[model samples]
Target chain A: MWYIAAMALSIGFGLSLAALAGAFGQSRAVSSALEGMARQPEAAGQIQTAMIIGLAFIESLVIYVLVIAFLLNGKIPAVDTIAAVMEKAH
Target chain B: MSLELPGWLAVAEEVFIGYFGPSYHESEAVFHAALVIPLLLLFVFLSTRRLEKIPTGLQNFAELLVELLSKFCTSLIGPHGLAFLPLIGALFLYIFTMNMFGLIPGFKSPTSNVNVTCSLALVTFVATHYYGFRYQGMGYLKHFAGEPLWLAPLMFPIHIVGELARPLSLTLRLYGNIMGEDTAIAVFIGMGIGAGYLPFQFPMMALAVFTSFVQAMIFALLSSIYISGATTVHEHHAAHGEEHGHGAHGAAQAPAHA
Candidate 1:
């Protein structure tokens, strides 16, 4: 029980760090895009599109970490069903 | 913390029968590593066999490849980077080949494995600090200690944790992407065959190819960026000196502000 709680807390902490990093990354990317647009006004459309795509890629890493955290926390329904059955039999 | 699931959800299955050491595991990443080792070795042997002042055919192509890689590294690490060209080139080629291996039949991409991705990330982690130390000597250790005595408490943990996170994030990102794509393709293939929907494989195949290439590019680009960051010294004062000119006023005032 304590072990599981600790594991969950760590996962939650890791996820928050990832989220914070991602937020910082996205803001920096947007600011860079805005700066580029200011430098070359005509290329704003292209710059914005590229920035959005890049932001998606960067954010996807955080999403991947979140999925892993969920997986690690043993939250999958199929696996939980099997484990429940095994525990009942035991 | 391990899941035991049945049918296609079970990630491992024998892909092929072989007369060699063991039965070739279909989804096992070690099989991919075994294939990559020899392919990379052969490439290295052939490319390094002969020296040519004026090159032609395969040698010309190989030299051109090295030249381009050299230019990329040099631009990232400055002119002195040519010394590390062989290491970076091998890393890029090995990673690129390992990544492309997923497109081959009956072979999983070794890089698609978290263990393999972590190994690669660890290599990069070591290489970054190794080069940093090589260039800057023992003072490279000071990077962790913070610039001044006052901020060490705050900066120390942040710097250390951030450094540790690099490999974890790098490995997890690459592994998650490649493995997820591989799983999706497998699921698609299984479902398509079951439903007699063969056309579904085409789009999945196209997606797999695109994902493999993009993952390889991202891995290489991130590794290069990390190497550049680790090696290049941040010259905050130099920039200030340039702005205010290199006279006595600039140098004395900057120290006063500090």
Candidate 2:
């Protein structure tokens, strides 16, 4: 029971932190790219491509955390198992 | 997790199991991947059947796709990149089509599966190293040796690890994104069913369309960047530094008007 709770908590906390970091990193990248584009309108195309790639890289890091959360989620007991445990305890 | 739509292939699997006494099972991802190949082949064949100086209909669309892909290849990997048009173009089409397949009510994205994405990433991995060796010969090994020569010991292992991580990261990135998107849509759809089929997943489906295109382009772009990095000669790197730049910065700046 404790194990399951810990896993769930870790997954939630880990994902939240990852999402927070990813949002900050992506926003920074987009803002910098937008500034660059504004400064040199002719180079907007290049800036946009760079920004997208940077976003992907940052997004991938968050996805890594997501994958880990998924793996942890799998370790949690299924509903049927949990129900069986409760019945046995009672 | 419990509520999910059945893809066409899943329905077929059910029929097959009924006939074959539960002994036969086929993966939906495999079926979808197979379906995509024949569809792409047919499209290409039809589009190229009657080429003209002044294109029309499917021919025009085909030319546009080819032109865009060609420009993408050349812009990233230089003039010689045209040689890889077939590989990169096929990958772009295959991945894009598979990604879009999930949006269809009776279809699922093959790329949402790790096996499919792993195989695709492995192809890029193999091709990158192959082109590296073919173009740079034994000097390709020097890539791991790092610059300044004395840092070989520290850099060699790091480079090898980085090289290995590329395909792993590629596999996970594509698989995770598509799978997450598909799962989100499925969950929303399940919720909608409880809510009297309210089309709750509509927004997600719309977002999937944009993400599908962006993911496909990113995969192709990253593949081209890897290939160009591997194929570029050591001296050429310095020579083209001003014109082409290097790494992501160079690739970003390559096609100013693109």
Candidate 3:
């Protein structure tokens, strides 16, 4: 029970953190692109492209953390089944 | 609280119904693979076989997809990206097709199964490094080793962990969105269990459809990004920094103005 509870809390916290980081990264990307456009609208195309690439890299990092939370939360396969089978054999 | 099938997959399945059967629910992966593979191949054949000097009908649609994906990939990976197009395009199409399968009446999405997504992600994960090595050669293995010997111990595990996490993240993200969307749709549709019209069902159904489209697009976009990152040389960053001057724009820029 405690294990599940701990997993749940961690997942909640990790997802929230991922959401926050994604929002910040996305906004920063948009803002930077806008600034570049304001300064040199002709470069908007290039700037926007770079911003998106950078934003994706940032988002991937957050997704990485989300993956960890997922594994911890038992969304990935758990060892319990294998352990139980072994215990039965013993 | 309630769920309904996405319209696109529903329409697709309606077009080719008995290609899938009621009893054959468990082997969703094979069913989806069979259903989508032909349609996708047909699309490719139709799109390419014409050799059109001027685009029309299927040719136009093919060109449009090509243009969109090429531009998107090139934007992220830079020029000389044409080489990676076939793999990236196939990945995106396969994922989106499998995801949309969930909305079909008798067909569950293969992607809704972790086993399926994991396999797909593993392929992408392997492909990413394969491309990385193809471009950079055995020297690409250096990325796993820290430049400074001192940081090697700390950085090596982090690098390994990060790479391992990529496939897991990709699989989970795709699985979660599709499964959640399908579950929501099912619940909404099931509300009609009691009532005839199923009051308040229409809006939920519409939202579920929208979610499906968004999730499909997100998966395609992210996969493209990963592929692009894998294929590109990191030298561009140094060149870009020199050109853009991230240092020049300093803290003098007002926070609110930003």
Candidate 4:
């Protein structure tokens, strides 16, 4: 029964945690890069390139979490069994 | 807004049995591979054939593509990057073509599969480490083990995890994005998820095409970045002062940039 709840919780929380973190990191990165570009427009090209590479790296972390979520789903207990057990408890 | 998704895509593709390594199953990915490889080869052949002094048609388009790719790859990797043109160029074209094919009505994109993406990531993984060892020799292990021998126990695992993460990330990103796009399209066409209009699906399809291009560019760009990171040596760069040609020198010159 707990396994059933754990499956959904992990899938949801795992991905959301990743997504939330990634979004924050990306926002910070883009804002900082933008500020640097604004300060010195001449170096904008370098800033942009580095920003892109850094962004990809940050996104990879979220992607890893996504894969983990999928793996977690693979071990989820049979839904009907869980439903039956839960209903009997109720 | 009724969207029609073909039935075959719902299941695996064809499979043939028992040759050398288990029953060879030709899934949608392998089927796409069968189609894409020959198509890619034909494209290369046609674009590159004929030694005309004045380029026209396919020759012109091919040259422009080569130039653009070379510029991008070299800017990322420096002088020795020219040697990588074949690998990087082929990767870009193959990925780009497969992605474009995905945009077509009835075609399966090879990159939509994790297996296909993993294979490509494996190639990049091999190339990165091979070049690292070749360029840095015994010292390449220093990269994996990190600095300070005492930290070996800690850093080694960290580096190992980091290295392994790279290919896994590449595999997942490509597979997830493309596959997600495919699924979204299918969902949209079948029931019109949000907009609930047939014409709304067109915009989604357009978005898929745009995403295909962006993902292809990101894949190529990230591969280049990884290769450059693997190949760069602080000692060699400082000693030789062989700055990358074109516009990258500006980045190298700016000490405070990064």
DockQ of each candidate, alpha-carbon based: 0.16, 0.49, 0.09, 0.30
| Residue-level lDDT for B167 in candidate 1 | 79
On the 0 to 100 scale, the lDDT of residue A4 in model 1 is 60
Clashes of 3: 7
Report the C-alpha displacement of residue B48, candidate 3, in angstroms.
3.2
For this target, which candidate reaches the highest DockQ against the unseen true structure? 2
- Per-residue lDDT, model 1, residue B132, is 78
Q: Which ten residues in a row have the lowest lDDT in candidate 3 chain B?
A: B245-254
Question: Model 2, stretches more than 4 Å misplaced?
Answer: B1-4, B16-26, B236-258
Error of 2 at B7 (Å): 2.3
Q: Is candidate 1 or candidate 2 better by lDDT?
A: 2
TM-score of each: 0.68, 0.91, 0.65, 0.77
Q: How would you encode candidate 3's per-residue C-alpha lDDT over B1-258 as one tens digit per residue?
A: 113344444555567776655434445466576788898898899888968799889889988988887765565445756676776677777777777666656566777666788887888788778887898687566566645557778878887887787677777767666665676567766777556756545675466566555555555555555555455455554445432111111111111111
Better of 1 and 4 by DockQ: 4
Give Cα distance to truth, residue B130, candidate 3, Å. 1.2
Best by lDDT: 2
Candidate 1 residue pairs in clash (backbone atoms < 3 Å): none
Give the residue spans of candidate 1 off by over 4 A.
Answer: A1-57, A66-90, B1-27, B46-57, B234-258
Ranking by lDDT: 2, 4, 1, 3
Candidate 3 global Cα RMSD = 9.1
- Please count the clashing residue pairs in each candidate, in the order shown: 0, 0, 7, 1
Per-residue lDDT tens digits for candidate 2, residues B29-91, read 887889899999999999999889999999999999999999889877777889999989988
DockQ winner between candidates 2 and 3: 2
**In candidate 4, which residue ranges exceed 4 Å CA deviation?**
A1-17, A67-90, B1-26, B193-197, B236-258
